[model samples]
Target: MSTPSADESVELEWDDIQSGALHERPSPYVGRYVLIRIDDREAGRELVRRLLPAIEAGHPTADPARDAWITVAFTYQGLRALGVPSDSLDSFAPEFRAGMAARAAELGDVGDSDPGNWEQPLGTPAVHIALAALSPDSVRLAKVMERAQQAYGQLPGVEVIWRQDCYQLETGRTSFGFRDGIGQPAVEGTGRNTNPHEAPIKAGEFLLGYPDETGALPPMPSPDVLGRNGTYLVFRKLHTRVAAYRQYLYDQASSRAEERLLAAKTVGRWPSGAPLSLSSDQDDPELGADPDRNNRFSYHDDLDGFKCPAGAHARRANPRGALDHENSVNVRLHRMIRRSTSYGPSLPEGVREDDGADRGIVFVCVGAHLKRQFEFVKTQWLNDGIFIGAPQEADPLVGRSDTPGVFTIPRRPVRRRLRNLPPFVVTRGGEYFFVPGLRALRWLSELDS
Candidate 1:
């Protein structure tokens, strides 16, 4: 990968890119995700044509407080079902064509990654399109859903096979009791909030047709108009074992304080979202609340991983400049824009044991290159430990662990090791879809033949 000059400025066509793909639009206090399949080619095309106007496009401003937004994405099969040309279809990344299920092993989902175990509409071949409706409140989201239902109802060939409703918890914590969606990368041109030290990455890194960190434009699908401004999306439904997670903390720690500390070490942050690197001795709720400071620290100050363990979940996910000192890997090349939301009810405070409740996060990853950005992080950074200098460890928070796993925490005198860790998160379902530019949506709708 060639490194692009940092001073180069590239203008982004906001109207062409999908809105939800870039902007940190208002958090959907309530959201509805729907997966559908196309049964009739002509009907599907007609549906796209009619739905094109409702699809939100990227813009300089977004006010979720008063307006709801609906974003549409299509699977490889969905494009074919809509009559996209063969040459254009063949131009997409091979992984997109193979689908998420075919690359399950690379994502660390093998023994339990089979489609048979996935939720309805996901494992089936009929899952061709995904629709997400987000609003600031439940009533607004319902209205959006109603409009979507009415539109889809007009087309008999389009079927809504699966649906998942997600919402922000009152406590602002995921099922695992950790503050969620705190760490997000700043896209070079999105104009979203960014910390002082956080450098804006190239627009091409997250959107097609722009120069990536490598200084080269990523491979886009055929027909410049159809592929430009488009990006690949990875949607996953992860189930968290809240009871088991709490139980493990209790079993490992001698006291409640120790338990909290252990949890923080595992996640690389306190429950309040404070990084251990800044407040290593205790949880600092104030610092965590301050976005400017919470995400501003890097591993360069604490290279030995003493402040924040090298194998910690957050560290493993984004090493920042930790691996850059050796000039081995540039952290910017593998960054991904995260849009994850909690799906189930928060476990009641003081609940120490398993309640048998189904709860987790609906993780959505958006990027221009699925293989280099998303897949690389999943396979190399999250699953393996050699890169971080810990060979026998996995990400303590979300790594696949059928057998006992290990988490090493660097400390003075002797390093602390947490052993016998089980898989706290499981992949219930997932899919890869192409979020087209607004113009591309129209192009897809008009395509014949």
Candidate 2:
């Protein structure tokens, strides 16, 4: 595909969209997430371009750039969808593949590498295909997804299923029972695609720009090197030790969940976006209404950790207090649009003692810089204990390690040696991928065709 032309004049505005502010707008109601799995890298990308027309055609608005938001999660398997089970899935694979191949032949490939008719990017690779994210406003987006199944439902070697999403956060980090999106930089825009405020808009600002106060960005392609609108996505299926976590909580206090849950509320955003801080003592329905009130609160309260906590997920994700003179830097540089969902099964009633129902979260992050936001949370706050003041290693909930997993609690010990601390979360699988803008998508499809 031809190199994408840069648009240097798209200025982004930084607006305060905390949980309280979001509630005034309207709950971001959404239904059925559509995912498509493809093989290998090249074929997966080609298929994505080929399917763009059909996918975009399904939307009510004809303009894909403004109306559609597409993010690709690259793992061992390029694209895979969860929670979309239709009976016609068996027949849709081959037809879609043929369409992708035909489109590639129509437009010659363009880039540093020469190409002709190429094999599907997968020889023995597995991938996931995520469609344009459908917000509450884009009601027709779901219908388009439904129609996609009609065209290729019976294709073999592909599985489509339905998923129950638990939470969605700013900076694109889902509620994984661990702190995410902490210390993320804010760009000047809306949705989960653009950068937050407090950061520069240089061509490589988010991607491969010069290193600032922090260490160098991860070894990934910068927007300058690749294109302005491209960003990387990381996906992982984390298994939360619900039973063990609960046991540790109960052992510590009379009502552990109730106490911690309240702390979450004070922060104005629940592990999910329920916003107990703004709504009722329980999960408030209206907190999702006003964005002004929902996301407007600081843990600096002396409320005995009732409204907020010393190390709650929301607090840990964005420790605004740590910034210049009371987290002024955090307010500017640590804002990210987190978009994540829960995976695995719900905890069964009365079935305590670690059943391993395989519950955790699907962590998906989008920002001008992937390493700055997602990677930072993973390596620093989540994995490194230094951010929390404790002399420990890794996040008690979702930190990474070479020796399986670990967890930590205030009082008492459950798994591991409570003293050395153990990981409360475990990682099953994860991979890094890129999400491209609509213009690039069209260019790719037309070029290879």
Candidate 3:
């Protein structure tokens, strides 16, 4: 595999890029996600024209420290509903044109992932647009929502069909009790470097008009300004069965310590967010808290999967030089930036029983090439076991299986296998959207019908 020459000199124009859900690192304490549909093409365009200024850019200081920030995106149908020209519409990735629901089977969403089970507006063609607002607190978030409502109120054709509010839990844990959002890839030119050893990927890998891992520009939508700096987004509403997850851990392990270790091994990270490759023997809260040390470790040292199981969830999602091929350069090509947030009520801490509450993450994956980065990871890496040398095993945390799933724990003398693993997470809904740059938003607003 050929490694792209490291271009550390590349610098991004934050002002030109939209408030990238991929690399902005908003870390908003509160957020509101609104799904919209366009009833009239003309009115929708006018609405976008009127609201363009309010849409935040990717600039570091775009959002006031105390106030809220807003970002907007549209689905393929949403762009059509707004009367985007046929030529421009045809330029989108085929997967975006196909929509997320049509590819559910390949994504391992056949049973519970079926579009029939998704929320009303999600899987259906009704969803045209998504508006997201992020703020430091609930009050600020409410004000942002109010502004959005006021802006939309003038456009009768734009209708909000669904809204989801999310916040950071006190313990900083997902519903499954694991540290969330710890492992994020550092994009080139973003100025947000997390791990020193991890090479900075090409900007085109996550943004349009820049060189990608292939050293070639990805296929961008027509009208250069409209496509530049824009990226594709995969939005998913995943519901975690916290009670079942907790119970499964209890049943699988012989003791409390073993249970914790089992959970860490399954996820490839301790509850504190320290990677098993770094803190294999115990959970290191200090190391987990230190971003420099936590995300710095790689699988190169533990190739055999003894310290961190080869089939672990994080490992499966991002092998990070752990693959038998030992090709870190190739692995970088498939990397994606995650901008997920927790939704619904947080299950009471230390409570092992099911509270029967709806809670999980609003998973948002942002990338330039949907097929190579997002779809490939979802279909080949996360859901399938062949890539990592585990043919029958799926991801222990999120992989779906009807009969049973297997998780292999590589240990000395004998390898331990967890069998009959049931699905702990379910997809409530999802959609594909195009997050355009600020100029692209303006260009869209001014498109000739």
TM-score of 3: 0.94
How do the candidates rank by lDDT, highest first?
A: 1, 3, 2
Q: Worst lDDT window (10 residues) for model 2?
A: 16-25
In the range 130-151, model 1's lDDT, one tens digit per residue, is 9987778888888877777777
Q: Clash number for every model?
A: 1, 94, 0
* Residue lDDT tens for model 2, 111-169: 21112212223211333554434334445545555455543365544444323333333
**Candidate 3 lDDT, 1-449, residue by residue in tens:** 23233456766767777664553434547888899889998778887877777776654553434557777889999999988889999999999999999988888886766778887778789999899877778888888777778778757888889999898777678877888777677778766555556677888898898889898999999888878889999999998888787888899989999989998998999988999988899999999888777877678778789999988999988988776364433888888888788988888865778788889999988999999898888778888888777888889877865447899999989999999888888889898999988888888888777
Note each model's CA RMSD in angstroms. Answer: 2.8, 13.2, 2.6
- What's each prediction's TM-score? 0.95, 0.56, 0.94
Alpha carbon lDDT of each predicted model: 0.82, 0.39, 0.82
Model 1: worst 10 consecutive residues (lDDT sum): 1-10
Global Cα lDDT for candidate 2: 0.39
